[model samples]
Target: MNGNRNSQDVVVACSRGITPGMPSFAEQIAKSAPDAADIKQRRWIYIPYDRYTDRTGPLTEQSAAATGVVIVESTAKALRRPYHKKKLVVLISNMRHFALEQAARGVSVLYVFSPKSHGQALVDVQREHALPELTCMTPAERELRLDLATAIENGLQMKFAEDTTWASRTADFTEVYGTYKPGKSYVMDRFYRKARQKTGILMQNGKPVGGQFSFDADNRNPYKNQIPVPKPPKFRPDPITEEVIAFVGETYAQHFGEIDGFDLPCTQADCDLMWRFALEHLLPHFGPFEDAMRDDHGQLFHSKTSVLLNLGRLLALDLVRDVAQAAEAGAIPLASAEGFIRQLLGWREFMRHLHGETDGYRLLAGHVPQEHRRFTQEVSPDRTEEATKAYASAISKADPYAGARPSALGASLPLPAVYWGVKSGLHCMDTVVAQVIQEGWSHHITRLMVLSNLANLCGFSPRELTDWFWFAYVDAYDWVVEPNVLGMATYADGGLTATKPYVSGAAYINRMSNFCGHCQYDPKKSTGPGSCPFTSLYWTFLERNQDILAGNFRLQMPYNTLRKKPAQELMQLRARAEEAIAHLQSFKRPAY
Candidate 1:
């Protein structure tokens, strides 16, 4: 329905369920509505946490006013995985604020505080309102989409409106990539080039504006004390946000990250300001240092816009168009503009498209060695406190390479405590993990080059690492994290998402980041006590997986190097890898 529809034409439904320890804004709204009983009977629009704003989709103030709005706060959903505390605070607080904004706009809002899951809460709303039909936009994550589809199949009169927030839709993805083929691999460059042509972004006179679709080659210069990195925009929590912080702190005490310094944009206005900050301050240097990491700066030259974009506070197309205009106007360099556009119109869209097209977890499930596949059955939910304790106990007591027999192949080691926040004696890991713990934010480079790379080398279960990423990052969702962790970083999907595993020893890490300088292990060494774990593990991983990886052309150089290494040297590298794994397994975790 259009935004200008009359109130008599639509009914608004609101559910009054609040997550525990949080104030019931929905309940307060219900009590204050002009006709509470009449409001209950009206058809209502339901706004999930991910769709809390009107800027992205069809949910404008006038439309919401016609049929009332249902905003639900569900404890069950938040606890599905012990999400980063800052992530919870951002999501719940933005949702609460959106409800208040709607109420202030003369829209009858039913804010529900439910102890049940979001699905159950929606069912409650359907029954309470006696509604024959409910309308919601397609959810971003596949799991939620499937849940809603099942509800529809089971006789819920629900209609899904098209999601208009993204730059590209599912049909567009299909047009470019066709249907997903199980064992076939897809390259991102071809998809990116097609998207650029289809969208006419950075195109001039029927050609790319700069005669090239990507400036990635020009975008990898490390920060060598050239220009000072601009600080990312930070919003001080207002009273509403402070209350959210307090609530999240008390309720999700064990969740990762502290909520005290939560500074993410919660409103459209805040999002706009952050966007401007990114364009004016960060965008210029963003391209050159996009792959660079620093020990002192966690956000270094990166646009902290992913969280806002994922949360629906900012629309992707709008941001991309504005960025393109700035580039066209010569406000930012071509490399900077192209790099940013590539992320928005290229990688981001590609990941989301792949996520919808395939079962990423299922694709990797078959490739995991039988012994490691059973590891999933043994562990609880991979990131919970119980799972952490269990994994720690197992690692400490069990042989580090117990199941990884026949040359340490099919290694399925559980994630260690070091991944969360403990000192791993590796400066790169310790620094990045600490950043993830404190801020729940890290740029793409830190995630792939440092975090996921180390996890892959350590032989951690791909699913376990993927789950940990889902629980840890603010920008993480099932759709994004699964493809990235399994397909791109770890190559657990057997290179369906990447041409080759993005694996490297300390040389690559040191080249891209300042992390190795502070590390206890020498980046140049491969087998000594001070040997870099990544360096030792790098050779070992290549040796163990050589039979499987030999045919891949991209891996030929690495395989050649492995072949050239002396037999005794290869054996010593294996011994070093075993020692490293054992040490990592037995390392004591310190209380943070």
Candidate 2:
């Protein structure tokens, strides 16, 4: 913790920067409150939220003992982006529920309706409480961290404690990677191996269990229709949740997705139930079909525990131990156990470290253009409605490449209507986008191989794609989406987080999923009306970016294959690709 020692009156200010729904910090303070109350300089606590802002933190019995908690319905964060209706509802409802829970427990709660910013609301809170000093856990988001600093600079005596929610810290990342080096890319496998050794997870006698660090090879078998996919555990909405649904429907009518069918786990009991269900029903088959995609199945034996983990309802360290114990007991396969552990203990931690280390890749010049405007700025809140309308209108009147990123290779194609749930005649793209719009969730394979793969291949702006992901997904945060989109998916970082761009053609999609069977275009075709857009665009993408990508050893095979194609055939494919691009850009919403 960093703060002034002289200040007699200090209040803890908990913001929804990360671990939104957890009551860990509040509980810690509450346990010490009785002892501190005897002293003249007793420390108070405050938790604040804006109405239309984001997801709310859940309240527990311990948090109900807090001296005071504040809730504000701020217009600043609500209109920050046109967040999904369901997303807004989830946040506001959870907050309202928490506040109500606290009030019922006899905790003094200050629920405010502040139309301004969170910062201004904090100032109002300070005046009401007559608190001279404020301290909080360091926020996970870079912007929110800056906001806290600004508040301190602007006269609020503020201090921040180290955020201990995540398994790894910035110091751990620095100890592993050393100082930031430009143009240096760290591989995930190496980092994962180190993490396993350090944490002593899956280790025996100083060696990895099964004499291997990764079971990724064993984890890739496509679903052969042998095993039935398990449906995710669902919870019926209670009165509190129902009220949130009605409130969101009225307030954010313009936001995306339906407010009905809200079945997410909001409390500790709900999360516990979901976790048990995953361990029993999903874990056994999760590893083998982890990357497989099925049109008929959405969950596909995957654990939908990300929301719970991120919200602090479930601890990452605890979950890892549970998985390890289960694996040792022979309840779940080693491959399944190891794969799931790698996600929480490996990729998830790496993404957070990479997000902070890269600083959104702003520190690395020439990877992406300096003048590239953020999508949020373009759709400013003042003119958000007009900007959205204009974007829709422009999609109809413009070329696909009109607003694409103007990088060295000129991948300047504006995102087409297809990404916004408009049918693009391609079954894979249509299905993925529709699912995202409806549910605000998709398994990683669908996101990477299908959604991000097509975006990278088609030259959609990386920043634009990242912003779409930020607003669209329920579990998305700046710390996760940036590296995933720009680094792993789009290769916008010029091969930093990912060794190579995760771009794929129709062949990869056909091999992994059942989508091709329903598509109007043939996955095997590379030209003409029947040609799959992904097939044509794959070649065009390679041909256009050969200057930058031709030297990559991993891409040599695809380059050699492109070299063998007849000149006439290549030209026809390029023409077909342009036609496909135009069709996607036409802004004509197709009937499903």
Candidate 3:
């Protein structure tokens, strides 16, 4: 898998970002055991819109062997879908810096600004250079993979090198659990423990450190403004980044997020500084406050490295290794270290494998009958041609399945305007959306508990919510958001990714944060005009889904409590829940 197919004039096509420390597949191909004379020269190509990595292998060999390197920046690809302006800036700027760094190593680097798809760009490069064959790491996305397959059909002789970006490989997932079956539930804890055993991370004498595999229970202390939340260190834009910011600002002016004060890491040096800041100032407190949300402080102790990690600026396993060492050296708590590692090795890896196993849940989407389908939404009439094409091709195809199980509670409502910028009376919902509008990022808790939770309660389409996450978040990719949103967040997969829907009542929100204090609605009330929307909706959700959820072992207490409610009171709560949904859908301030 590491070696390349035999070719005298093979062009190595690199992805968007390549880790300096890690040997890319192109580098591996360069070092493959081939006669020096038979391999005349190697050409390299880079497409910046592709997706993540770091390892210590054959970097010098690849750079020295390459005759030329082409880094293509596709404006058309950037315009293909609605993305947060900040996300585009980060990706394009990082790509630009990466190209300059590669060129500095004495390689003949050609930077191209293309207004075409990646496949077309690569084909053009091959034809221009007279390269006989093309090779690239298997793309991380389905659409891109399909595009490449089409290019191959159109006379581009290409070979796909194995994708080695993730902490856990596809084989590792298969080893843990045999080939994934539809409707089969996979437990994250089991996979996390097995991964720990395989990697020996945070382990001593063949057992987990701190005498356990997870410290998740200890990592959920809600923030009460008691600890000083460190401001994320800013990386001032260099001239290259400044140019990219200006370009993205004007070109993507209609995009979702803000571009002013763009301070994300655009180079390996900036990424290093950000990592160091997390180690010194953020990791120690990250565990307890990992689940906490604050209105004033959007990212409390969270290491906002997902953007960098996904962009191949930082490696997931590398971070996990460093965190374990830090914990062992007493630089951070075991809970904090374990909590962070769980994300990289457990959730991130699990999501990737599951996404592939399920064909990005497209199989489930394809199964839904047309008459019952509400998942597909039309592209907005005002969108640009590229954006419209992207939305129509992606969204309309995501037709959610109507599973045989009652637990697959059908949620068919369209995503509300509140998600886009309209006012919702709920303080938590409005506050999180405001942050997403500005930064295109929020901690995972806010995503699950506030955004996805409310959407589920209000019966919003899972596909719509999933696409929104894909476009709106800086850290989101299709592989990451599909499992997280459809399975864990909304339970659209019917216990495939998670055992139960991560829904909560207003009490949980009030217990976790101060949002309820600022709202006019009563968190304790489950009925009437002044009742908190979440509180009212919580009971109604239980009542409505009772047929599906009553048999679940985890819902015994909630169902028992629901059964105790008087019939008249239940009717009133349902009416209030409907009123709350209407209030949210109104796209104006609540008429208090």
Candidate 4:
């Protein structure tokens, strides 16, 4: 009903960021065609997915007769690698609900189930439906972009337009950071400030409202049970979503994570509940305790809108706009609003553009030497040969900087079974892993501070850890996970994505969470049998990589401490670190 169509071209909605009322992805395709008649008669918009959800960009249309929309469920993608059960349910249910919603809106929808790859499946849809030419937004993932390109080369006529889901684009990154060179690190704060100036989100008369661009200093306080934590909003599954849960539980039963409490919003109507809950219940206290974690509460004060945003149910710009309005009206603190906005406008966009700048997956293995990288075969047995080959092709051979000097901090250990739900005696490790297993989610701090930090200190391979994060979390995608895992968390990129390593001792964890109180290990003892593994390994990490890290200005204090340590004491610390690594390794389970 949006516009008239006679079917010269069909729009394809790759459902990573497909929501209504946005501009069409075929505008350029329509404009480029010299015949105005050819551009005027568009009748169908085809929406596609594989393994329920895979694409990271959306095809939008404000005016078009989307008489038909296509949704593809590719079994090849599902079996390509074992994914978290909750992740599968979230994706499949959302896609199904989207299709039904479109059908209700009077659009003819074609839902396809195929055993082939995503591109081949799309080609099949185009031929089966007799669609003349397919047009879509450029995908956020490089692999998917290449997949579609291959389909195009193989005779599937498709035109691509820019994706509108992000607040910024490749040009935006270049506008602020200049043309990206391989192995160069871009500071996020600079990009964030520039973004704030351009968007005018928290600005008053060409200046930031609070006289600061970031409230990160005020956002790092530990939770002290000051306010009663609110329970997350749960939407009972409708029959459509229930069917998806049943399908995932029956089909991917062996996949990691539990599907019992599947409460994510699958429809546009339900997305508001989460937004309301976040503003009313979670936003007030979200800033101070943003970094805090508790064993009892899985999500303390975080909004968890990443899944919704990543799923295309909500728009990033809309969320930040509303948040800024709320802050202006005194509904929330300025610090809280700024903190939330910084994540989307700052970190999220930074990660995406950085992923593009560094050439996506190639960033993981290119800088690290061959001997230091962890291939998919060495990390987990669950990935199919096709998946492994695809992964190897993405990272190993296509890297533009494959000959770069290997980082001194690169690790080669098989990802410890501890990451796959094997119990590490440390309460922090167990608590975070249990959260991931149950919900396939944890806040950013838990991800950076606990899970990834332990992996780094334990010397687990960064590539293996990166892959584990991709399959383990609901919000994870290659475009987001690689920068976070390889660049920021593990510092395996030789300081290209992060200024310094994120490693820390038990003291940071103890100050941040209640995990240490319930832990069997003593946080104070670095060498004794009961010493905390994080504390012991942290010192050893410093000693092992001092020569490389000593030159880093940000790491000067730690390096100074390591240099001043007595010879015998440092030797004992190394012995304790070895013991801790052995203890952690003993709990290794086969990767899921």
Candidate 5:
């Protein structure tokens, strides 16, 4: 589809930009091969008409066939970018695909997909040479569409070809955001109304209604009085998703992430179905139990829209609007609308802002001490020892299944024993993630309160915890999950995201759901013999993080609770909690 005439040897220059029309992943793989034959691993990086972007870098690095290509982890690595251009380069790294949209505007083009050190990998191509630059760069789509032009121009060796991939990174940012005033009441009103109107969410005396907003109070109520709602129906698979699943199975079979059967609603039609299930089944009572938890059923009353929202298959405004509409229709109450809206507008946007600032590269730099918990290395229960062996047949890792070392701010916290006692306390955070990889789903509360709260309370490194959030959640993106994990959830990034760390005891879960009643631990006790893990862990957490949290204005009340307790008794409580966590499975659940 590209205008470039293919040569015997096509070399996609080390590029810093990406475009949409470049061949599909499978096709790119075919193109990469000397014979242009079909190969697998082609579709693991593939997204359909929908662009697959992670914003940090391109997807395709080298051509293996006329239709086969290789996935590049990041544009900087792909281009072998230099130190001076590093910061600016990151802005457009793998997110360079949209550069092609600009190319249609008639801008000068000089493209390289990788560095000269990689040799003719991303540069010029000779028509008959063994390897030429017929190469196409695949960066994440959002980067080109969203990042500033100046940022895209940072690391390139400027030269011109009749090339038409990226028109130019020559636009002005001031001229763009300047067109619309952000903080005006009218602007806010319009965005709200637009959200309402887009989703037909709130209808009033005829037209979609306004104000009387956010019935979140209703949503905050616990759902223990109610019955458990069933999971919505799943769409088995369409040809596209089926193909993707198959491809991931063969090629990425060994990749860190999981590939469940095609249960994800990838198409717009499927998303609508999933949305309808939420509205008809989950909405009316969704708010009251939004924050509640179930033992194994993680998504109690929570909106199941994350999978749809992040994939571009659905819009945020519509989602919030629909909840508003449901409230107005009296189909659901106001509290539900308010609570869900807060998640979409308030928290969703907040998370996106957080992602724009950080994406986890800093934590991956091996900065954390090895003494920290090792997840990647831990062979997941899900992986067979044989599969694990084969997966690691080539990798020379100290622990083949081990994950990257966690940062001081993420998993390296000094949690005391009492806090460590609850199975509910900083659960096998990594274990659940391994499950998520296999299942492709984790309810909001599971994500927010379960893993997130546990990690936060247990003193996991904020950065490592944030990375786990990104890696585990299907709906997670830097723009969506970063702040939620880094700021609000973990209180990592040192409190820029939340007012206070969300910490609680078994009592909170007891009050919220039926899970405590079903547990072997007693929700009432702070001491022993199957004391609710939440209780002892709560105290244990307070003891551990007290020093770091002493200056926090929001932690005043909890600190007071800790102060009232006698020191010796506190020490005994903490001791038990620590022993509990190290051998979490050994503890029996006491009768509720």
Candidate 6:
């Protein structure tokens, strides 16, 4: 949620540019001020990013009434890493803006732009004032934040307190959640109160705002107007925000995601707009249509809430509750509600837990930097040698029922996919990469069919595939996308998320969509210039790697089809397909 910027005593912190979802540690430290009832207080300081005259004056002006310490600085470079110049600007500018907002909330910000380490900051502070009891920085995820704190603590060496303001000191989410369990009912029960407690969501009758807690089916109707699809909200940048955009561009020049248009919500009001749209219009048709795609609906059926939800702008439980209520209110349906809830509760939580518990944190670790790869959700893969690999991998990784961890992960199964590296062949790397870079989002079909298919087809290296996907995409977190992409999509680690590779021929594409009509190549014509690229590639992929695929039952159809091809005829077909692929690559953009 967007905090009111009117507080005079608040100092908002950041490890990077503070967006709506990102938590500011400066605010946290100030907010965590030792309750004051006991009065055995320590000195605290608040830092801002802008030139400090306005913010710092308030702190010095009001310091007489405020207990302990409070100094507002324009730059907290000492608290952030200067390793990346972009990081410095992002962190400082965001902190500065947030500080101004907090000043509006009545807090002070001392502006400083020195790239000094925390120890140096302490020395400077001591020279300016006296030894303070504590140094509270803003909320930041980069390791440098902690590094700065450690440096300050080491410098102070018992003279001042340095630490995160969070209630949890250890990686003890369990301790924070208390008796929460991972099962369905156990999860549901804990979700009610725990969600509200941790996230401050409003509740009704000891339950969530929505009486029933689901509205999936209602959200699945594909037919437009079945549910009113309102315009998703956007923030028209105020002068301050426009300046922030310019600052981000000039300062954090290399940041991965595009800042152009920069219209995605970054404030509480922005997230609320998205949430309101989902509840009133999308929740009713999100499920059944969740799986469907249309050219006209850029974000059809799907609620683009990842940015908000991940950043804590919107609590997952509250979102679930609202959708459920909407459904119950005759706004949506059961399937859609259930599906949406499952994704939020089951998929998202599982991913967070998986990475938190396993080695999936860094993806693949080998410096080999596997080849780059690409793929998506409406996936259908090649039914050849690659498919055999995919099948074996899937069988090895498949959860027999659901939530049942497979026993064959190591002792009997192929290695799991490391979320590292650039993937090679069979997976289409650039397509989805382009999509994510251009648009801060991707579709399931694009992932499964296009990217995944290309990955297997191209044989792109593993590590490259993993890291590229993780870094480029906005919504990619270690949990879901890693398993889905690294394991299920890329099949980089042999097989982790799927049993077999998804491969298909011209027929399959024809079955799915009208892509054939718009293409210059004909799906029906093989072994010639007019032959479909997919059809030619499909056979070449099979023939080139028969050793791995000859035995796969799924390959029977395509292989049988290949067997009908005379060697000379197959070579011509391969040539045609290769030409098509080359054509695809030679272009600055995909003509289609």
lDDT of 6 by residue, 278-353 (tens): 7777767677666443334446667877645644446666677786576567776667776776667545654454
Provide the global lDDT of candidate 2 against the true structure.
0.68
Model 3: per-residue Cα lDDT over 58-121, one tens digit each: 2232654463445556554566556788888888778767665554555554555554556666
Q: How many clashing pairs in candidate 6?
A: 131
Please, what are the lDDT tens digits per residue for candidate 2 over residues 1-592? 1122110111122222224354532342243322323221333333433111112222332344544444455544554555666666666555655555555555555555444445555666666656646545455655455544555666656665555567777777777787678778877877788888888888999998889999999988777797887778778776556655655565445665566688887655676799989988899788999988888887798887876676555677777888888888898899999999999989989888887886756666654453254443323223233223322323453422122232433454677778778888889888988888888888999999988888777777777777778777777767787777777878877777777778888998998889999999899988886988898899999999999899999999999999999999999989988888788789963321
State the displacement of the C-alpha of residue 345, model 3, in Å, after optimal TM-score superposition: 0.5
lDDT of 1 by residue, 1-592 (tens): 1112121111121222234565445444555353555465545666757766677554653454465676767654565566888898888778877777777766777666654445556776667766557677777876566556655665666777777778888887788778977666778888888888888888987799888888899999888889987877789875567766766665556666666678887766787899999999999778888999999988888887898888778888888888889998989899999999999898888998887786544433344443334443122121333223322323553532121111113557877888778777889988999899888889999899888887778788777777788878898887788778777878777777788878899999889888888888899998877889898889988887887788889999989898999989988899988888787778664432
Q: lDDT by residue for model 5 over 475-560, one digit each (tens)?
A: 55444555566556665544444556777777776676566666566778877677755567678777777776767887788789
Residue 361 alpha-carbon offset, candidate 5, angstroms: 11
The local lDDT score (0 to 100) that residue 370 gets in candidate 1 is 33
Per-residue error for 66 in candidate 5, Å, reads: 24
**Model 4, residue 42: what's the lDDT?**
48
Tell me the lDDT of model 2 at 351. Answer: 85
TM-score for candidate 1:
0.88
What's every prediction's RMSD, in angstroms? Answer: 7.7, 8.6, 7.7, 7.9, 12.5, 13.4
Tens-place lDDT digits, model 4, residues 1-592: 1122111311232222323443332331222222223233544444544222213343235322334455666544554456788898888778777766655555445566554556777887777656667656566666566667777887777777666767887888899888776556688988999899899999999999989888889998889889999998788886666666766665555677788887888777787689988988888788888989889877998988898887667778888998999999999898989999999999999999988876763543554443445353322233344433433443555543222223338577777887888887889998899899888899999999999998888888777777778778988877788788877888877777688899899999999899999999988888877888788789989888877788999999888888899999888888888888887888647534
TM-score list, all predictions: 0.88, 0.84, 0.87, 0.87, 0.59, 0.56
Ranked by lDDT from best down, the candidates are 1, 3, 4, 2, 6, 5
Deviation in Å, model 5, residue 443 alpha carbon:
2.1
> Which residue pairs collide, candidate 4?
47-70, 417-588, 417-589
